[model samples]
Target chain A: MAVDEVKLLGFWGSPFALRVEWALRLKGIEYEYVEEDLSNKSLMLLQYNPWYKKVPVLVHNGKPIVESLVIIEYIDETWKNHPLLPEDPFERATSRFWAKFVDDKFVPLIIKMSSSTREQKDKVAEEAREILKTLESCLNLNKPFYGGKIIGFMDIAVAWIGIWAPMLEKIIDVKLLNEEYMPLLNTWFSDVLEVLVIKECVPPLDELLAHYKDYYDRFMATKA
Target chain B: MAVDEVKLLGFWGSPFALRVEWALRLKGIEYEYVEEDLSNKSLMLLQYNPWYKKVPVLVHNGKPIVESLVIIEYIDETWKNHPLLPEDPFERATSRFWAKFVDDKFVPLIIKMSSSTREQKDKVAEEAREILKTLESCLNLNKPFYGGKIIGFMDIAVAWIGIWAPMLEKIIDVKLLNEEYMPLLNTWFSDVLEVLVIKECVPPLDELLAHYKDYYDRFMATKA
Candidate 1:
């Protein structure tokens, strides 16, 4: 196991950081987790990710790899158990495409929803509705996860949506991803949360809310 | 041959579009190139890619794949000859990471460098120099390409730099990426242009400069 010593530098409340943690756990890969204070990053974090200056940098045998999804792919390939991606090239492409779509489309919109004032939340809801509908189409009611029955790459890529979106909706007082607008995606939110692996990784909601509230206060103070 | 029919819907002026063209030619895959007018999009283009409505949509056996790099990866996997990616997992991950860094960091900085007015161009040059320096560090003086000896995914991903950056320097009158600042990167640029597969795919300099001039005029008019 000495040859397999993996180290992950992460932050507690960040969704991107959580992704690496979940991937490591899913693959049964043992990694030493170093919690980073993003306000003042560690020397190792800086050395690992000089460009992004962000969390979720995976260090394996003194080599540090940045980018969360890239880290997941590396982890999946490095460890042969519980495959995250598909064997077929097209299927793998599809998973990567949607995972990218989720990052590009939904992540920013969710941020916009969370960071807006209560008055602006209502106006942002329309754009949020359209994004959710597009995401909704990617899922299948017959299949439990995005990559079919097993927890595959796309499922792990968006596992944060289920845990985080509900809190954002509650905080902003806007209904962006509820069942009426996006039935299948809404169902996915519920289903992915119930998966034992995902459930364990998501920190408690109250704790998350407290963290986000502090963020919201900081954002509001800046606006004022 | 019938089942393998691949069609690329693209705009000649776009570097992103050129990437797919180069990959297809390299792999010896036959594909029909449909020139798209971005201002007045075709119905098929709209139908195939409703969200981005962008070029370089690769249609293989009827399904349309969007996103330039994603399409290139799909093509490489599907065709398999003259492989764009390495078979090793770590090497593959490194290729993906740098490809993404090019897109996220270098591409936008290049755009900023290209689009700025003469007065602002001087200020932007400092930033451009930093980006080029970081990119330079990735190369090896001993190797022709990023992966060495052969043309690869990183070479294709960044081949635009060789073709476009020189024209941009001439147009903007800014010398951000010269041999002094980046000897290895400057050499990489020269080496990439010499490859026959790349030579055939890149549009002529005069045509590209004219296209960029028109873009520059449009950009100025909007700012005015």
Candidate 2:
């Protein structure tokens, strides 16, 4: 017995939840996926993630782990099959650096989408551009994936947002990750999507956009 | 020869930079600390962290690790002495989770400090309260530190801002972490400060306040 009882509590419309699902699939690990309704969260999910009380909680042998990036790393460490991070410490540190970078920058971009004024949106746009530029420069364009041959933890951590950016641009009527403007990011996006696991794990663009729209509306309505 | 030539490039007033300093001191690792002027960052520092070009870049045995939290973890992993994270996977994940939680919440608080409008300040105040409540609830008051029996990675990671919350309250004229409001957080502040290494590493409160005031003024002036 491999202590193989694994389960995930997630929402289909959530990109954060998808990161964990994709990592589990990529590792060829079998587990149960319990779709969480955000409107009516399960008591188990709430109990497991009492701090944030949010989705994508992974329970392994009855122990719970929250936060998508944290869960991904946990999975990597627990099951050594199909290594997600590089063996080299320097490489691993570099990848984790970008993961934090992406996580930190996501906040302001979300605020921009919920901003009530044009000035605020413009300011956020500039902030978002700087973050995108940082990501662009850090990326190794010559590599087929973020990890060169295969997707790694950094790739999985950011893989969801890469899809969301273009869809968001479409909905907002303003481009964020334009191929003409960011040739490297554009190429990397295509390369990331080439992976069967990632492609399958991604929710449809239309559905993601709809979710973002609903979230934005709810956020703004609360403000009003 | 242990290949132990370690040098840290950092700015004097950055909390992020202080994280590495505190970790090194706690681990009893001797290293050179090179304070870089943020306005005129050293070429080596720039080259070492080209993407972010930010402070708290640690070079160990000639290899550079950027990002404060990332560098902290790298130092912990490489040293394998005076361990900052717990050995158990679940506990380690929990420590990392709180660290990430702290990192995530500071964004809005920083933004509020930099904003011009009272409305913006109010919005951030609400956000800050939510984060504080989470912290005050998640943390065990009886434990002297976040990691019981010792000041660990999560404590040092957030210690800079944790100490500054009172100073931040002084500036904004609001008491978010006062004993009257949050007895546990207030007590934890003194608890963390009781550590000799952490006590010595903290910059003077007056200097920190002065730096933030200068920054806040300039930021608002630019917006005007």
Candidate 3:
């Protein structure tokens, strides 16, 4: 049976959740959004995601799909308009490879940098810069975004960087990317953030900073 | 231009390499396999996969696609035969979620157990059993393989568990999955091993054991 209704379970400030929101909006699919507090996860969130209990679970026709990337792929395949991924098989695979890179290297580094003290944050500065440098190499000075003129799967997958990095830099006092460090990537992030869809998903900067500040403090305290 | 030729650079015992091999053979696609000696990677491999500089680089026509899962997806889409993933987008997403689980939890736990001291090996036994138990629950008292009746993507993704787990058990002296702990999963592993395509990709057990034993020794030495 074709699914009739669509719904999403998410937290407002979560980059993972934002990916789904942006994909759905770009596809122009209308759906209800349920915000979950990570501290006190609701029954629906727990029921939808029994294993990970994480947000960004999409419920289509009452069936729940988990994991942000998996959810993003689901949205792309289900909605034909505004195709997030490329049509070519090899191109699709290349985009997925970069998506995996975002998950494996980029997101974890952001989390680690966010949760570290000033000294500890300094320790990962070069490693973080190297990741951006790799991204710059992909840009090739002519391509505007990861998708070569379009906001692509990898671009949306990385959209969090534009929104979250500024907050992280503010709290950690570590400059991650700039014209000096990664010229192309710095411009790419700027380009991504300027998009209407991308800008709409980003929580207000002041609210985000206040939330991450407390989150970082709690995270580091537990680690200590 | 359409991709005219396919080539693979691989090392014999790597599960990652075996994934590409099984996917190609299952699709009944003809390709040249270049065996790599890990001690000295070929210039082609270095050029094809300069990022990771690792084996299991699939050169379709001339372009290189790295990463095991991404390469498998590319092969499935490009060939259009014996589809590795399900047709339904949600089902495809579900299989990928488990594939991520295998990479994130299953492989790491196996590596940790393989290189652990006797005491540490004993400590991870219960944890390892728990992971298998969760997999067993996914079976829900039915389903021969992760892809239902077929030896599909997840089955290929996890073929290593069937082959390598037994070898790890013998060397580490820790039973990961068996009739007692995860009966359905143990049987599924056995059945997957019996697949001709899967069996052909696996290195001989004695050779694998010897290779892994040395690998474990070197891994522990570095940690010590």
Candidate 4:
């Protein structure tokens, strides 16, 4: 049976949710957006995602798909318009590589930074530097986005990292995206922000900052 | 230019390397296999995989694709003969979810079992149980493989993990995949092993155990 109704369950503050929303919008697919409060998730959200119970679950014709990357791929394949991946086999694989790389490296780096002691944070900082170096090399190829000409799968998959990188610097007091350390990454970030779709999809900077501040305050209070 | 040559550079003991071999065989794509000695990797392997400089790098018509999951996708797209992924978008995403899950969870479990201190072994064991439990629950869909009937991408992506799981239990003097703990997983293991491509590509158990023992010995010595 061909699925007609597409729905998204997401938290407004979540970059993962934003990525799915952007992909759906770009594909010209109309989807009902159900905002999820992460602190107190809806019964529907829990039912849809019993395992992870994470937001950014896409329900298409009543079938729920979880994991932001996997959801994005589902959206792309299901909707033919505004292709998210390249038609070329090698190019698609390249994009998937970067997507997996960001998921594997960047998210964990941020988590480590958030939870680790002062000494461990230093080691994580070094690890983050190495990951950024790899991205810088990929950028050196002169590709405007990770997809070469347009924002493709890799860009969306790592979109959360791009959004969080600047905010993390504020909390950790480490200038990570500066031109001095990561010139290419800085350029890439600027290019990504200039995209109309990405700009629209991203939550306002003020709201994101407020959310982070609240979390940091709570985390520190617990530690005390 | 439609370049038809497919070459896989691999180390014998690596499950990642075996994934490509099984995928290629499943697709019935005849290709050249170059076994790389991990201690002394060939220049071609290094040139092909400068990023991680790791084994199981697939060079298709001179372009290198590192990472096993990425390589499997490339193989599927390149060869149109036998499809590793299902035609349905949701089903495809489901397969990929399990693949990513196994990739994220199984790799750490194997590494921990192979080299973690005795004090840390129990913690790792507990973590493995949790992940395997998730897998078992997902397996309730009544599928022989991760997909309904035929072995799909998730099966091939995780085929290597099942091979390593038994071996790791031997190393730790524990039964990780016992029928008592996970009867579904035990049945799934039997089903996955029944596939001809997986059956043929798996190296002899003694060979893999010998290789792992040597690697573990050296790893422990370095830690000492």
Candidate 5:
């Protein structure tokens, strides 16, 4: 049998890339991580993911798999131990649905919040709060994680909320995940952050804040 | 063991709904189809999918699974026969990546073309054509389907381009899928339409045309 060679092409500050890193760590898979410069992308990064030309591409052996959620699923399926997703088909579907919701609905709101002007920030934060409420309703307060006691797919998918949400709140001067309104989600946010795998993979807070601050400054400059 | 009870709540004009219908048909699964009125949604639809309140909700044994792609995956996993996804892990990821591309990138462009103004129509069509070229490059001219020889996940996910692209071109008065520019994709479109299950489930052309025409008129009126 051939040795399994796994390589991940990622950008340091990307939440999407961090999801892959967390999944790999949770599964205990040893792999190489190549950080790509988004400003001037590496040739291999472009070649591996020509379609999106984006990071979080997992190259196993010689073949490359793009898309973070897809790569996580790939890793889960390839390695049976420490399953990121549930075994039941229905539970798996639910996991996938929530993951999609995070990427499609929730993540975009955060990005919008990041780029919004002073006038637009309040409305964006309000809209984000509404989404957070919906997310809060779905959580099982009894369970420590979304996958019921284990840190699984949903935990990894929503890891951004744990790591980035607080930073975003500080950056935009808005409170989106108040415990009074979203108790379950607020608890889940804190619980997720404490997970050793997640804690280790999170980018340094000051560095991440600096990165987003720079991003915000650039956006404001463009608007001005 | 109790017999499987599958129910799909869908809207006829929605390509998202149509994908689910095609998947169930291809799997040879017995399912009850409930048509949703988007104007006044059913209580059951709202209760089942409170977050999105959209169609293509698959209720299996009373458990509702929203999101067409997620539902299709659930169906594929539950039923053993006529696999929609590839068996190999890498191949499954590839199928998923393309399915997502169809929804995320290609479908949105088509929807934009539908709602665009006369001035915006040509530019949207041009953009749609560029996407078609990328899709075309991925097809194997020798293979009949994106899954190769069989209508699988990718085919069902992209069924809209086969069924709706022609209508969209007529509706918008712009050419998007020229055989000269994208021979393989154009051929795949025809081939996918010819599949017995897909051909049977496609919405009546005259009705579909009227539906979209009314939609276009409403948008234009709003703009005016």
Candidate 6:
């Protein structure tokens, strides 16, 4: 049998790229990671993901898979040892539903917050809080993670909220995941951050904060 | 074992609902279809899917699954007779990628065209055509369907385009999925419409067209 050749093309600051990284690490898969310069992307990145031409492209045995969530699903299917999605079909469907919700609804609001202007910031934060509240309702304080007991697919899908939401809150001076409003989500965040695999893959807090701050400043400067 | 109980909550005009109906029919699964009144939704619809409170919701043996694509997946996984998604892991990933593309990118533009102002109609049509062109490039003339010979997941996800795009074109006095610009996609649309199960599930053309025309008139009246 041929050796499994796995490669991930990613950008350091992107939460989406980090998702693929966390999934790989949680599965204890060995692979090469290539950091792409977003300003001037590598030809390989372009060739691998022509549709999006974006990061978190996974190459396995010379076949390229794009879309972060799709890549994660492929990984879970290929590797049986550490199952990311649930065994039962209905549970798997529920997992995919929330994961899509996070991607389609939650993440976009967070991204909107990052680029929002002085006038737009408060409105965006208010909207983010509303979404956070919806997410809060779904989580159980008794369950340590979205996967109930283990750090599973939903954990990886949503881990960025714990890391990036705080960074945005600090930069914009608005609260999103307030303990008063979203206690379960706040606890979930704290617990997810403590997972060793997740912690190992997260960019250092200080570095991530600085990066976000710089990004916000540059974006605001252009607007001004 | 007890007999399996399956139910689908759907709205007749919805392409998303039709996708679920097509999947169940293709798999030869017996299901009770409940038509949802979007204006005043049923209690069961609300209870089953409080998150969106929208169709199509698939209930199998007392468990409800929301999101059209996710529901289709659940159906495919539970019933083993006919496989909607390919067996190869990479092919499955590719199928998912295109399905997401159709949902995320393509569907929105078509929906936009529906409510677009007289002024916004041309630009939205232009944008829809641009997306259609990209979809065109991915399709091969040699293959009869998005899944090559068989109508599969991608086919179901995109079936709405063949049905709704032309309706929008007729209503708006603009053309999308034009034969000259997107030959393969146009051909693919023609071939998919001929499929037996798909033919069975599609809403009657006259009724669907009248519904869309009425919808467009009401929307325009509100704007005016």
lDDT of 3 at A145: 74
Error of 2 at A45 (Å): 4.4
Please report, as a residue range, the 10-residue window in candidate 5 chain A with the lowest summed lDDT: A110-119
For residues B28-133, what per-residue lDDT tens digits would candidate 5 score against the true structure?
9999999999999999999999889999899999999999999999999999798899888999999899889877887777778777777788888888788778
Each candidate: fraction of true contacts kept? 0.62, 0.62, 0.97, 0.97, 0.97, 0.94
Kindly report the docking quality category of candidate 2.
medium
Stretches > 4 Å off in candidate 2: A1-4, A39-47, A50-53, A110-143, A176-187, A205-224, B110-130, B140-143, B180-184, B209-224
Itemize residue pairs with steric clashes in candidate 1. Answer: none
DockQ of each: 0.71, 0.60, 0.88, 0.84, 0.94, 0.90
- State the RMSD for candidate 1: 1.8
Higher-DockQ candidate of 3 and 5:
5
Q: For model 4, state the Cα shift of residue A116 in Å.
A: 4.7
| Model 3, span A53-122: residue lDDT tens | 9999999988899989999899898888888898899889988988888788877788777766678888
Candidate with better TM-score, 3 vs 4: 3
lDDT of 6 by residue, B1-224 (tens): 88899999999999999999999999998999999999999999999998788899998989999999899889889998789998888989988998898888877877787777777888888988988887777776788777778889988988788999888889888888788888888888888988988998899989999998998889889988
Using Cα atoms with residue i matched to residue i, what is each candidate's TM-score against the true structure?
0.95, 0.82, 0.93, 0.89, 0.97, 0.94
Cα-based lDDT at residue A193, candidate 5: 84
Residue-level lDDT tens digits of model 2 in A71-186: 98889888899899887778889889888778777655855665647676656766776777677776875776766678888888777767877766665555567677788877
- Candidate 5 on A69-149: residue-level lDDT in tens? 999999999999998898899999999999999888888888887777777888988988898888777788688888888
lDDT per residue (tens digit) for residues A117-173 in model 1:
777777777776786787778787788888788888888888787777778876767
Quote the positional error of residue B176 for candidate 5 in Å: 0.9
**CA lDDT, candidate 2, residue B39:** 85
lDDT of 6: 0.88
> In candidate 1 chain B, where is summed lDDT lowest over 10 consecutive residues?
B108-117
Question: What is the per-candidate TM-score for chain B?
Answer: 0.93, 0.93, 0.92, 0.93, 0.96, 0.95
Can you rank all candidates by lDDT, best first? Answer: 5, 6, 3, 1, 4, 2
Model 6: DockQ score: 0.90
The number of the candidate with the highest DockQ is 5
Better of 1 and 4 by TM-score: 1
